[model samples]
Target chain A: MPDPALPRRVRVHEVGPRDGLQNEAAVLPVEIKAEFIHRLAGAGLDTVEATSFVHPRWVPQLADAERLYPMVADLVDRGVRLPVLVPNARGLDRALGLGVREIAVFAAVTESFARANLNRTVAESLALFEPVVARARAEGLRVRGYLSMCFGDFEEGPVDPARVVGVCRRLEDMGCSELSLGDTIGTATPGHVARLLTDLHAAGIGPDRLAVHFHDTYGQALANTLTALRHGVTTVDASAGGLGGCPYARSATGNLATEDLLWMLDGLGIETGVDLRRLAATSDWMAEHLGRPGPSRALRALTHRDTPTPQDKEP
Target chain B: MPDPALPRRVRVHEVGPRDGLQNEAAVLPVEIKAEFIHRLAGAGLDTVEATSFVHPRWVPQLADAERLYPMVADLVDRGVRLPVLVPNARGLDRALGLGVREIAVFAAVTESFARANLNRTVAESLALFEPVVARARAEGLRVRGYLSMCFGDFEEGPVDPARVVGVCRRLEDMGCSELSLGDTIGTATPGHVARLLTDLHAAGIGPDRLAVHFHDTYGQALANTLTALRHGVTTVDASAGGLGGCPYARSATGNLATEDLLWMLDGLGIETGVDLRRLAATSDWMAEHLGRPGPSRALRALTHRDTPTPQDKEP
Candidate 1:
């Protein structure tokens, strides 16, 4: 049975094609990236972040975003929500030209992360995103504001929830329909998650307008996500096969695997509309293309047994 | 800050030497196992489970239990609790001969697991453990009962919490002072954990006398553990560096890494008495001895950045 404290259903925001592939060292072909997004949607993911429209110099791995967008246009026409990331007005224009209906703007919650990741201070990055978000909203596009480093920063010890609330309020005021709170360093704990959600609620930013994007760097992603769900946040951001890693955190792991999240949701009797087997197969196929096993324990457990020979000798 | 609903402090039951190494393919020398235990104790693990006294043929990796226990007996002298696993009366006799202060007996919550793991029916295994637990307690040794497959079984489907409560009552009635609920297959989720604990509590088994042993096969270990902690379970079972895997399950991963558990507990502001860096360094050292990277994400994130070169290309 589902926990009474949790939502009855959750929307999994699939970010494998965009957030996931962006950090990958191997630049997958545009066709492969398009196919991956298609497979994820086929596996019952309603919303798939297709790719980022960031400059090629900044993210060479996703340089083919312009080409990739048109390839998966059929899925978007079929009612699959393909939300692409737009860094600024230039990226927004690129996304708009492709007839994109949804887009996300990335912002850093801390000055250190803002300077390191965006090459701008917190205020400067938000200032840059304001016009992009306004323009996207004006075009009848759903804008999602991604607030990175909401939980903690590597350079700064512990993040203040008040600081996160302030940024969230600014993003909400800027007309972003949803806010995906990012634990970029993945150093968040359950209590920390609870405190942040509580603070956000106090700031009039309820769970209905918020989503959680967690990294598994310290193995706290799923636990933190659970805490968020208990607080009535229904949307969770996960990468297929645990694909993405944080570039700033020196030894960061990938985002929480969709398979792992599905296992927990399925066990809880919560509805996710995801087929675990099909999703694991997609991740397994992707793992082969990457020439390395995905870091997701669920993906490994579900698919590894089918392989004739075990990869690791430990188990 | 610690969650008000969770426990203030947790007792970590270190199971690397016994449960972890027993599943490893490599058989380390007795001295290395003893030194591993010493280092774990030195890293602030007060209750380290020593080697198992099961038959050498069944668990050859931990076959050096006899030689190993005496080498780390100094830890016992230093007020550290070093409990070893004893399968039956014969195993109990071996532990008793070595002046072991505490020993744990293994049982299964499901009939399928009982037959598969112990090669005996549920009743037969309990019948066998009766005398062992009685004898150990009669000798003034603290006896712990390990009930495996408390969540789901590989052959059987979802296990009834009432059925688990029955086995737990039997174990407690058999003179066992504590019961460690083992999700051997790692298929459990947070709600299931809360339900099992609630059912056990209804059967008069409180969290103080219960410990949780979760595997990371499905990556739900830490999340399920957080639920257990919220339910007031104070003792958690974890292995250093995630050293073990299930021999029965086709692709089961290792136990919840002690380093990962430490990361969560430390982040929650719950006192565990463990130094995270020291514990991770110890796991990293053991990974070298095992010739594989440890499965602990916290261990990897904390120590991997220190190495000059990156190991995996994904991140």
Candidate 2:
């Protein structure tokens, strides 16, 4: 009998071009960011979050979103998923006008992260996103609701799991096709993950409606991913080269690296449909461009050609 | 009720002083090496591999083993376990003469690694160690037998599990206190570990008589460790600051970092009695001396002072 906790296949949401670059210190040219997105899609990622439509004045790093949207429109037309973050109805309108077929709305479980990140409280942010989710879905665009700080906030030691479940359930009820639970601080362990998922399940949300987004801050990203996979979570969000960071936690690292996640997925015999070698090479290029090796160990090893191919295939 | 696959507590074998340092390119001063061992023992690691007795002609990095022994001799008398690597009868004599109560022997499951590393065929290497093992035990020393390339070899991929089981059983029958299965190339995955441990269990060997060693070459070490823990294996081998290298795969990173393993163990609430923060500090110091940051993400984040202490406990 198949294990109840493990899934047969997983969907990888590539967030390198958007979430990764947003948290990076050095901003890349529009052309380079465009190329990075294409490279990730070419690496066989089905879903690639292209960019956020938050006001350019607020996020100058993604100022080229208007120009960037046209560059990857071909992939969008080809049915390759390109999700853009929409903070409110205004952002949703901007995305829909660009012929975008998928939009993601962001909210935080804690008032502190919400106020600091979005300049609104949790209730205020969710209320703002309600119309955005409705408008995006009404326009025939699939909407994904992001629940950041689901595990814990930086200032808050541990956010109550009941509050997390309430926030997630509200998102689902508000027409979010999926809710990506964010471990913003990377402090959540396997036990925390298991417990949170169990509580969520008890709160009438199943793994089928959930995706896990974890940061590698404390080095538990992959282990947490493994636990999530065992609990039937088939969708994972990762950044190429582990790009991005938490504003509150200065020393905290980036999102789980795509290559690191792929290593474990490939090892578990679970299909991700993403080409490991190509994704690793792309991260390597981005790391070199950044002037430092990013946090992904697989990228470091693969780029160095340290991995041993089978003798039958070796020269 | 507790889960059947997981263990309550685990024993972490700190090989940073011996295995970790030997693979490093920069040879540290003998005093630094001695102090590193003491620091590891001070961090609550009861078993710290102090050094190796291999010919100085072969491992000039550890050429100061003779001088190193006397430095930490106080820990040995204080009931802190210090196991040193003894590669041969001559090496065993050197360790025994130092009044070492514990020693380790090396063997390879595959002939290529055995031949390339020890200059002997697998059978010949095992034959050569029979007397050494006998002599070590005769002197009342606890001997650990390491079977490397158990998962696969550099030149030959996928060593037979039966062969590994046979080698381990022979070592056990020869009176070795424990057998550590080494994934020398670090190509091992959770499934590989599960299958190997399953076969080993069928051979009548449980976790008590076995320890698992892994290299983080592909970034699957911690995930693999979780799998091993589920199978009731309680002993894990780790290196501080993620020091060391594979003789076969140079670009392949070192053994699993102790901090990385500690993150999972602490998360799982599995007791190891080792202080995570203290160990991370020592690795930080060692990494600074090495002129590079070590691979442990926990060390990177902790040393960055990013972790939040609980408010009720914060000073």
Candidate 3:
């Protein structure tokens, strides 16, 4: 029998190639980015976020999306799924022209964050994305809606759960296939996450159509994920080597590390089909090119697993 | 009213001074170690692991335990708990000579780890600790037993849970006031942690007499801590700035950071009585002295909470 304590299989949506590198300080070459995506797929990640179609002025790092998509577009036949981020109707059109099958849109639960991040009010931003989501859905693209600051906004200590529920309903009503509830500040504890998910479930957004995107800002991401999982949420968004940047908590690490997520899943006998060693090696390769350490604890341990006998410090 | 989901108050056993520094590659001066301990206690960590009584040759980093103890001994009046590690009869004698009221003994759960870490068989190591635990209790000292590799051993993937239970019973029987079950390799997940705690409860070692010492090697420490808390565990071990080295996972980060733990406890409405900002400041100070970054994500966030708008990297 499957373990009742955990989901039988978790769908780990790998956001490294796009989400990870987008927040990084150094702008890696487009070749490295494509190779990173290929390595992630080779590591058995079923879904890898390829790139975002935001204007280059907004995110110059991911500006090569036009050239980057074709390099790995053939992977669809190999049973790998690539989801690209489309910020607006123009972006969605670009993705559609590239024949993208899945796309994601983002929104903040708080007006302050919404204004700061999107230069529009929450209502205005939602109105702006309504057509984008409709057009993307009409184009047969599976859309994932990222509800950032759902747990707590960076400007406000917490956005009301009812408000988050409202946003989730709006996004779902706009034809999004899934909603990734993000604790944008990573200040959420298990109790907070559990309460939010419980409220969302009561609001008719059950685990089946929901995912959790948590930052490690306060180091609560994994714990929050476990809480969400206990509430039957199976989809989790993680970045390889824990890439990504949090404009809210800039000094903080970004998304929960995929390797860290897989470690818990592996120990619980939950299947994700992601080869951890290969993922760690890919992350290690990326870290070398990034010229700094990745925030992933598991990646570091696994990468250094074969080091010589350790005796200089106490275990 | 306290949240039913978490304990009302958690006794954070700060292990940074001893466990954290001992694993670090760069050894700070004894005065810095002493100051760090003072700062931890100043930050309101009631239980601080001051130092170890092991021989200098074995743990040269803590060689000044004798001198260090006297510097912070005054904290006893301030309602702080300082427990010093004693490896054997000689170590206990050294601790006793200094009028130490709290002392700890360590024994590995696996023969392989026992040999590699202590250069003794599991049975032999326990045999050697028999006199030490006895004499410490006889001297009116509260003894803590560290059951290393209780969850999983580095050499042997995992030891039998029954074997861990037997060791726990023996340590309790030998007058160890508390048994700190350790995931020495930091590989334990929530499921594994829950299962072991269940078995330990079945074996008559309830949460009342148990604590958990987990490394963040795989980024599972806090999640494991949350699971332990949900299972009624109230005492959690953490090092400030997530210091310490895993002689096992040398590249792995140290114990769960106190700031990270407090962040959860604070959010869950659990009382820790520790100031998060001061703890973060102390960790930041220590990090600067160490000439490397601290691994505590919360400390990093709090340390950089006031930095100018972050557009340099992704979160």
| Residue pairs in collision within model 1 | none
* Pairs clashing within candidate 3: A23-B314, A244-B314, A244-B315, A245-B314, A245-B315, A246-B315
lDDT of 2: 0.83
Native contacts kept (model 3) = 0.47
Model 1 residue A73 lDDT score: 92
Q: Model 1: how far is B110 from its true place, Å? A: 1.7
Give the Å shift of residue A40 in candidate 1.
0.9
lDDT tens readout by residue for model 2, A1-315: 223457889999988888888876677888888888898988999999999998987777787888899998899777789999987777777887888888899889988888888888889888888888877778888889888887756687667788899999889888999899998878777777877888899988999999999998777788789888888899999998788866555555689988888877776677888888899888888877778887777777667754564311111
Interface DockQ of each model:
0.40, 0.44, 0.42
lDDT of 3 by residue, B1-315 (tens): 334867899999999888888876666798888888888888888999999998988777888888889888999878788999999878887888887899989888988878888999988989899998888888899999998877766556666788899889889999998999988888888888888888899988999899999888889899999999988999999999998855554454578888888888887878888988788889999998999878888887777756431111111
Candidate 2 iRMSD, 1 decimal: 5.8
TM-score of chain B of each: 0.96, 0.95, 0.95
lDDT of 1 at A201: 94
Please, what is the whole-model Cα lDDT of each candidate in the order they appear? 0.87, 0.83, 0.84
A1-315 per-residue lDDT for model 1 (tens digits): 456898889999999888888888888888788778888998999999998898988889988888999999999889899999998899988999999999999898999889888899999888888888888889999999999988777777578888899999899889999999998878788788888898889889899999999999878889999999999999999999999877666666799999999988888878888888899999998988899998898888888655321111001
CAPRI-style docking class of model 2 based on DockQ: acceptable
Clashes of each: 0, 2, 6
